[model samples]
Target chain A: MKTKKIATYGLLVSLAFILSYLESLFPIPIPIPGIKIGVANLVVMIALYGFGSTQAFVLSIIRIILVGFTFGNLSTMMYSLAGGLLSCLLMILFKKLKFFSMVGVSIIGGISHNIGQILMAILILESASIINYLPALLITGTITGTLIGIIGGLIEKRLKKFLVNY
Target chain B: MIKKNDFILIGIILAIVLLIWSLSFFKINWPMNFFMKTEGSKVRITVDGQEYKILDLDKDTTFSIEQENGKFNTFEIRDGYVDMIDASCPDKICVHQKEIHYDHETIVCLPNKVVLEIIDGQVNEVDSVAN
Candidate 1:
């Protein structure tokens, strides 16, 4: 059981890293700084549902670090850490509530991710004016988060069946 | 499994987003028109919450400001419109943003802590008139 759990975590980490790398390849035309499809969150979402919060937290941290080292700088790492940590916390909260499914949890995670990064931007810049972008960010977060949630729900269902057979 | 309630929740969230989105479009024009009655507006630049400089929109000029932290942003004011043509910030969000001519519009460079706001020069004139 121990070996299986470790193996699952290792695989999840690699999968998340690969998804982040793939996400960077797609260039979004919008110049808005903290906007992206966030394909990597899908992996995190799946991990949270499949294994649990502890494993999901570990996977998220490792994925952010590896992605930062490979494709980002110090500021990028700071933003990712802030966003990823908050998103993970919210996801766990919603998951425990049991009021919402994978889709709802993922949506909350996505929106929290943007809020965390925006807060970091405010602190780093020392400017309250950055709050001007809140409306647009929230809209984008909900749209992208819903899409990610749908994908995560489908994968989680498949993974459950596969794990049972294995 | 996504329950029926989840869809309702998402719908409510979307409605809230739609309201906020629409509100941004209706930004108060009262103050904007009040300021526009004057011949020209002034562009106020602030760095780290300190008033840096104010430029008249009547002049066509390009100027640059170098912050104490070594970052800089360049602005080009032409025909009463100001544009952030260049910035030393990592993301360059200000440079990519559209030019502004209306009163109270702002071009903000968060990484460099620079804020270029279009203020009504007439407000000061009005204050002086009151005095």
Candidate 2:
């Protein structure tokens, strides 16, 4: 691990942590539980494109753990872990396929993140009726994912100039 | 930078959403109601997957449940709708959720492990025949 790479990881992780904190402070007006714009995901997507899958995975895990402990409880941490891991894996897989652009990959990530949390909720609550929120969640996820992907695409272009050779 | 596949993906997702929305819509609006009459419905409360209480929707009343962990949730039944009025949970998502009146509608408080669902009050002969 190069020192530059390590420093970038630290910076990105802190950025993600701050975004998580800001997000928690102002919950989305929607009353639905486990719905978030996932701003921290922008950092993860950047890491995935600018860095690599391993770095993105590491950054996502660290961010979730840090944010979970700082702003949430054990159960919240579990939910974040489930959503984070699933979304990260899917984003990586989609990126590898090369069929979709950053926007496409991020949209998949957003949708999977919600699905992961809902699945966790179903397991913990032991109730299948909670699945009723899936359509709304999916729609929100898609919209938010598209927005984040657009922003990520813009950032990636500028970041490429500075982050040449990883 | 969007790609052709991205549009296709969005289309597929919208299609799935439409399918699910229509399915749930039809289940609640058309065929089920045509066969089984909703003479009345009751609010079924559960804690940790166990039945807690069943409240009549016709009679307006407020009810509260105290969990073993000292957490609590309070709900009100009014005019055939069940609404979660208060909760000790930090998120309070259940309290903010829309009031449920239709059968199978639910308001769940995960932190408190409380679930409020609407179920048919009395099973009629039509329901039995369909079953």
Candidate 3:
């Protein structure tokens, strides 16, 4: 790998880690567990669009591990890992299909992330009733995903010129 | 940069949201209520999926549990409603959740592995009339 690629990887991973830490500091007012704006995903989305799936996947895994150890426990790590992996895979697939724009892909990412976490929660808690939170989670995920996608789209447009050199 | 397919995707999601929202809403409000007049008479508490205690909602009281792992949760039943009053969990999302009085409603403290659910208490006059 080129030095520039390595540096980009480091930069994106650290940015994602910092974003996760910052997000944990400010809890969303919603009472639902595992609900967040997913600001860190913005970094992953950018990496996926700018670089490729492999880079995005690596960045996501490293960031999740770092954030999980720093701000959360083993169970929390499991939840994050599940959500991150599902969201990254789905986003990559959607991007490849070329049917939807970044906004649409991000929306799918957000909703799937919530679904993935909720499924993990159900498994850990052994309660099917916890699925009651699905509607609210879906709505919030859609809204936040749209916001992140718009911002990411703008950033990618500007970064495209510089990224080509690397 | 929003494409036509983006709108289509969002529309499909919204349709799903509406379908689910209405189904759950009507399940609680229309058919069940119209048939039997079900009311939540007992609050069932569980920890780690095991039954902990079932408290009568009619008697206003406070209950607290402290696990060996140092996780703790406290709740109160007042005026036929159950409310999570305190917890050792960092988020305390359960405490902030709205108090529940209807059957099938729940307050969950995920960090503490605690769940409080409103269980159907009595079959009222509606059931007899229908029968």
Candidate 4:
């Protein structure tokens, strides 16, 4: 059982990395530095509900490291790390709260992720002017985050059944 | 099945999208410069505010601009240069897009809360177009 769990987690990590990289290929055309589709979070969401928070958290970290090594883009890696960490934390918190449902948790996680990246940007730029972009980022973040979260939620539900049977 | 709250949230989202879409036409500003000149045309760009320009689009001929706010704004060339593009803003999402190509469309730098759009060339159409 232990070996199976470890192998399963490894598979999930690889799947997540692939999904994330695939999503990265989608050209947003905006070129605002660090905007992404958040597709890999779907896997995180699945792991969160189906595999448990601890497992999901582990998967997230591993995925982040793999992506960072593969892309070798420091700026993107920083954003991903900050955003992914905050998002995972938020998702877990919201899940515990049981207030808005898993989808809501995922959305909130997405928003936190963007905000984290923006904050990181502000610090790196050493200019408060970047804060001006908050409203716009928030608006976009919420919209995209929600969509991603819902998709993740659905996948999580489906995975729950599969995991139980397996 | 989506709950009533989810339904309401969706409605709210639609309303916000519509509102933002409509507000996009309010005033789009593209960062530019009339005084700065490249090899041939005038340049309009946004920088760290250390450098700025005042362009007379109607009075100058062959003007060029360098983007200041990165990808926040888009530019278009018509009788005059206009900024029209989409953005990542939930509201300003369409505001900070690629600048336009025709006489219409504009670029907006929402992070800078700036809008760059085109105006009628009637001010000094030929004189400014030269820059």
Count of clashes, each model: 0, 0, 0, 43
Q: What TM-score, over all chains together, does every model reach?
A: 0.74, 0.76, 0.76, 0.61
lDDT of 4 by residue, B1-131 (tens): 23455545445555755555454455322222223222212224333333345344435233333455453433343443443444433445434444432232234353443443333322334456787
Lowest summed lDDT across 10 adjacent residues in model 4 chain B is found at B31-40
Candidate lDDT values, in order: 0.80, 0.85, 0.85, 0.61
Q: In angstroms, give how far residue A11 of model 1 lies from its true place.
A: 0.2
Q: Where does candidate 2 chain B have its weakest 10-residue lDDT segment? A: B29-38
**For every candidate, C-alpha RMSD to the true structure in Å:** 5.7, 5.2, 4.9, 9.5
Give me the candidate number with maximum DockQ: 2
The sequence of per-residue lDDT tens digits that candidate 1 reaches over residues B42-75 is 8999886788999999899999999776788999
For every prediction, compared with the true complex, DockQ reads 0.33, 0.38, 0.36, 0.06
Could you tell which candidate, 3 or 4, scores higher by TM-score? 3
How many residue pairs of model 3 clash at the backbone?
0
Q: What is the lDDT of residue A161 in candidate 3?
A: 92
lDDT of 2 by residue, A56-110 (tens): 9999999999998899999899889999999999999999999899999999999
lDDT for predicted candidate 3 compared with the true structure: 0.85
lDDT of 1 by residue, A27-118 (tens): 57554556778899998998888878898899999999999999999988999999999999999988999878777888888888988888
